[model samples]
Target: MFLAIRELAHAKIRYALIGLIIVLIASLIFIISGLAKGLSADNASAIQNMKADYILMDTDAELEMTKSFISRTDLDNVLQMDGIEQANSLSVRMMNASVNGSDQNEDVALFVTDGDSMLLPSVRDGSPITQEDEAIVDASLQREGIEIGDRLVFGEESELTVVGFTDSQRYSHTPVVFVDGGGRETINAIAISVDESRADEIRNAVGNSFDMVTKDEALKGIPSYSQEQASLNMMIVFLFVITAFVLAAFFYVITLQKRDQFGVLKALGAKTTYLAQNLVGQVVLISIMCIGIAMGLTLGIAELLPEEMPFLLTADEMVQTSILILIVSIIGAFLSLIQIVKIDPIEAIEGAGK
Candidate 1:
C-alpha cells in the first residue's frame, strides 16, 4: 500500500488519465441506470405502487391489463376463495381528456376501481375520491396547471372532477387518474393481496380463465416497459465489461514500464504477494475515487435535467454500481499481476545496466 501510494503520487498525470476514463464510464453508467429506473416508474408506477401482491388477469389477455377483463362474477368468486385476503376490481384505460382551463387535450391513464378499494392511492393533497365522478390525479398533471376542482372532459358528455392529487402515479408514460368504478359490470383485472404459499390455491380457484401474475410480471405487461429496461441494462453491463478491459490494458502497460523497479524490489526480497497487494491497492483506491467523483457529477447533472426527463437515482443503485465497478477494477488489476510475477530480477537488472 505504501509503495502503491508513492508510485501513484510520483506519476500523478498518468494515474489521473486512467482515473478520468473510469470517471467517464462510471458516470455514464449512473446516468443511464437512473434513466432506466425513472422510465420504469414513469411507465408503471401505478402498478408498482399498488399494495396488491398478485393481479388476476384474463388468461387470453397475455398479461396486458388493458386487454384483460374480469367479470363481476369472477371477482366475487375470487373474493370468496379460501386464503384470498383482499380482492378489488381494477380497470386501466387510456384516453384523452380536455383540461378545464386549457385548449389542449392531455393523454391520461385511467385507473378505475371501487371507491373503498385499498388499491386506491392515498391523497397527497385535497380529499380522496368518494363519488363516482370524482378522481384523484397524478401530481405530474399539476405542471400543466390542472388543479383540484378542475373538470376533465372525457367525451361529449362524460366528465370527471379532480378531487385530489397523488404522487408517482403513472402508466405507459402518462399520468394516472384514479376513479371509482361505481359497480361496473366488468374490469380489466382483479388486484389481490395473497400470500405466496396460497398462490396455487388462488390460481386453481380462479380457474384457467384467468392468469395470476406477480408485480414484476405485470410490469412487463406494460407496453415498452420490458424493452426499454432491457436496453438500458444491457448498456450498463457493456460499460462494466469495457471498464474491466480498459483498466487491465492500462495497468498492464504501466506494469511493463515499471519492470526494472519491480525487479529491483524483488532482488531486495519483495515477495510476489506483497507486490500483488500493492497493485490491487492502487486499483481499489483509484476505482473508489473515480466512482465517488462520478456519482457526484451524475447527481449534480440529474438536478439540472429537465422535469420532463425521466431520471431517478437511488442510494441502493449508487452503492451497487460502485461495488460492481470496484470489483471489476480489481479483476482488471489482477491481469497486470501476471506481468509483475514474471519479472526476472537478473534479466531486468542487466537490461537496465545496458
Candidate 2:
C-alpha cells in the first residue's frame, strides 16, 4: 500500500488517465441505470401505488389491463371467496384532457373506480374525489398549469373538477387521474387484497376464466415494459464487460512497460505477493476516487433534471454499481500479475542492459 501510494503520487499523469477512463465508464453506468429505473417508474407507478396484493384480469385478455373486462358478477365472485379481504373494479383508459373551453390538450392516463373505494391515492393538496364530476390528479399536471378547482374535460359530457393533487402515479409515461365512473360499473380488471397463500385458492375459485397475478408480474403486461427493461439491462451488461476488458488491457500494458522496475524490486527481495498487492492497491485507489467523482457528477446532474424526467438514483443502486465496478477492476488488475510472477530478475536486468 505504501509503495502503491508513492507510485501513484509520483506518476500523476499516468494514473490520472486511467482514473479518467474509470470516471467516464462509471458515469455512463450510473446515468443509464437511472434512465432504466425512471422509465420503469413512469410506466407502472399507478399500479405500484395499488394497495392490492394481486391484480385479476381475464385470462383470455392475456394479462393486459386494457383488454381485460371484469363484469360485476366476476368481481362479486372474487369478493365472496375465503381469505379475501376486499375486491374492487379498476378501469384504465387513456384520454386527452384539457381545462374546459381550452383548445390545448394533454394526454393523461385515467383510472376510473368506485369513488369511495380505498384505491384512490392519498391526496396531498385537497380532499379525495367523491362525486361523478370530480377527479384527483398526479402532481405532474401542475406542470401544465392545472390546479385545484380546475375543471378538466373528458370526452363530450364528462367534465371532472380537479378536487385534489397527489404524489406521482404516472402510467405509460402519462400523469394519472382518478375519476368516479358512476353508473359505469363495468371495469377492465379487479384489484384484490389477499394473503399470499390464498392467491392460489382465489385463482382456483375464479377458474380458468380469470388470471390472478401479483402486482409485479402484472407490470410486464403493460406495453413496452419488458422491452424497455430488457434493452437497458443488456446495455448494462455490455458496459460491465467492456469495462472489465478495458481495465485488464490497460493494466497489462502498464505492467509490461514497468517490467525492469518490477524485476529490480524482485531482485531486492520483494516477494511476488508484495508486488501483486501493490498493483491491486493502486487499482482500488484509482477506482474508488473515480467512482466517487462520478457519483458526485451524477447527483449534480440529477438535481438539474426536469420533474417530468424520470431520473432517480437510489442509494442501493449506487452501492451495488460501485461494488460491482470495484470487483471487476480488481479482477482485471490481477490479470497483469501473471507477467509479474514470471519475471526472472537476472534475465530482466540483462535484457534491460542490452
Candidate 3:
C-alpha cells in the first residue's frame, strides 16, 4: 500500500492525468447507466408501477396492453375466475394533447380505465376520475400549467377536464392522463391485482378464458419499448466494457514504465506476489477514488438535465453497477499484470554489458 501510494504521489502529473481519464471513464459508465435506466423507465414507468399482479391482454398479441384490444365481455370473463381479487379494465391511446390555453400541443398519452379499480398514478390533486370527460393528468403535465379544473383538448376535439394531478407517471416517454371510466368508451386492457397464492389459478383460468397475461409477458406490449431498451442497454454495456479497457490500458502502460523498477525489487529478493499486490492495490485505490468522483459528477449531470429528458436513477442500479465497476477494475488489473511475468530480474542489475 505504501509503495503504491508513494508512486502515485511522486508522479503527480502522470497520475493526475490517469485519474482524470479514469474519472471520465467512470463518468461515462455511470451516466450511460443512468440514461439506460432512464430510457427503460420512460418507456415503461406507468406499467412498472401499476397496482396489478396480472395484466389481461389478448392471447398471441405482441404487446398485450395497447395493441391488444379486448371488449367488456372479455374483461368480464377474467373476473369470473376463482382467486381473482379485483380487476379493472384499461385503455391506452397515443395521441397529442396540450395545456389548456397553451399553444404547445405535446404528445399526450392516455391510460383509460374503469373508475372502479384505477391503477397507475394514484390521485394527488383532484378526485380519481369519475366522469367520461374528466381526466387526471400526470404531475409532469402540470409543468405545462395544466392544472385541475382546466380543459385539455385530446385529439383535436375530445375535450377532457383535468380533474387532478398524478406524480411522475408516464407511458412511452409521453405524460399520461388517467381517465377512470369507460375510458372514452374503449376497454383495451385489464389490470388484475391478485394474491400470489391464487395467481397461478387465476392466470390459468383467465388465460384459458380471456387471453390474460401477467406482468412478465405484458411489457412487450408497449410500442417499440423492447427494441428501444435493448438498444440503450447495448450502449450501456459497451460503455462499461470500454471503461474497463481504458483503465486497464492506462495501468498496463504504467506497469511497463515501471518494469525496470519492478525487476530491481525482484532482484533484491522482493517476492513477485508482493509486487503484484502493490500493483493491484494501486489500481483498486485509484478505481475507488475515480468511481466516487464519477458518481458525484454523474449526479450533477443528471440534475443539470431538463425535467422532460426522462432521466431516472435508482439506488439498486447505481449500487449494483458501482460494485460492477470495482469488480471489472480488478479484472482489468489482473490482465495488466501479464507484463510483470515477462519482466527479467537482469534488467535490475548492471545488465550483461557490464
Question: Best by lDDT, which number?
Answer: 1
Off by over 4 Å in 2: none
Q: Give the TM-score of candidate 1.
A: 0.97
lDDT of 2 at 89: 83
Tens digit per residue, CA lDDT, model 2, 179-237: 88734658898888887787777778776878888888999889999899999989988
Q: Which structure is stronger by TM-score: 1 or 2?
A: 1
How much is the lDDT of residue 240 in candidate 2? 84
Model 3 clash pairs are: 63-221
Best TM-score goes to which candidate?
1
Model 3 stretches with alpha carbons more than 4 Å out: 98-106, 118-120, 155-157, 183-186, 209-212, 342-354
Question: Candidate 1 or 2, higher lDDT?
Answer: 1
The deviation in Å at residue 244 for candidate 3 is: 2.0
- After aligning candidate 3 to the native by TM-score, how far in Å is the CA of 227 from where it should be? 2.1
